[model samples]
Target: MSELKTIDARNTFCPGPLMELITYMKQASVGDTLELLSTDEGSAGDVPEWINKVGHDLISNEKIDGVWHVKVRKAK
Candidate 1:
């Protein structure tokens, strides 16, 4: 099973959640996973795009209880 790390960016706004994920990714080892929770709609797509652009794996991007849950795996 993949590890799940949740980054709470609710009410923070766009790019905030994404930036948090990026920061955490820098310290994570390859194969580690992060589950990002954000209220910012921009993260629905932006997060995954960042994962791809930076060579990470997006496990999923789903809505759970009105929050966007972005699942990512460290690929590099």
Candidate 2:
């Protein structure tokens, strides 16, 4: 199974979670999956859009316990 890194951005605002995702992506190898948790409502939409813009793949996005869980795979 591939490694999955989790980035906890809960309670953080917009751009914060997005920035964290970008930073982690830089440190992650291609095909690696990342899980970003955030409480910001914008993240649900923002994360996926950013992933697509940067050539990454958004595996899933869901909300649990009022937190947004976004899964992304490094495509490049």
Candidate 3:
């Protein structure tokens, strides 16, 4: 199993969480899985859009206890 890079952006809003994800994604290797935790409602949509725009794969997105847990695989 591959290790997952975790980005805890809880309590952060919008671009903050998205920017953090992008920053980490840049450092992550291709095929690496990333887990993002965000409390921002916009991230539910923004993150996925950015992921697709950047050609990453979104594995899962679920909200648990008001936190959005998004898993993504780096494609490029």
Q: Estimate each model's TM-score.
A: 0.87, 0.92, 0.91
Candidate 2, residue 28: CA error in Å?
Answer: 0.2
Name the weakest run of 10 consecutive residues (lDDT summed) in model 1: 1-10
lDDT per residue, candidate 2, 1-76, as tens digits?
4689999998876559999999999999999999999998888887899998888999999999899999999988
Residue 3 error, candidate 2, Å? 0.9
Clashing pairs in 2: none
- Give all candidates' CA lDDT scores: 0.84, 0.91, 0.90
**Which regions in candidate 3 have their CA more than 4 angstroms from the true location?**
13-15
Tell me, by TM-score, which candidate is best. Answer: 2
Q: Give lDDT tens digits, candidate 1, residues 1-76.
A: 4466777888785568999888888887788888888988888988888888888888889998889988899988
Candidate no. 3 TM-score: 0.91
Ranking by TM-score: 2, 3, 1
Q: How close is candidate 1 to the true structure, as a TM-score?
A: 0.87
Q: Residue 29 in candidate 3 has what lDDT?
A: 85
Which candidate ranks first by lDDT, i.e. highest?
2
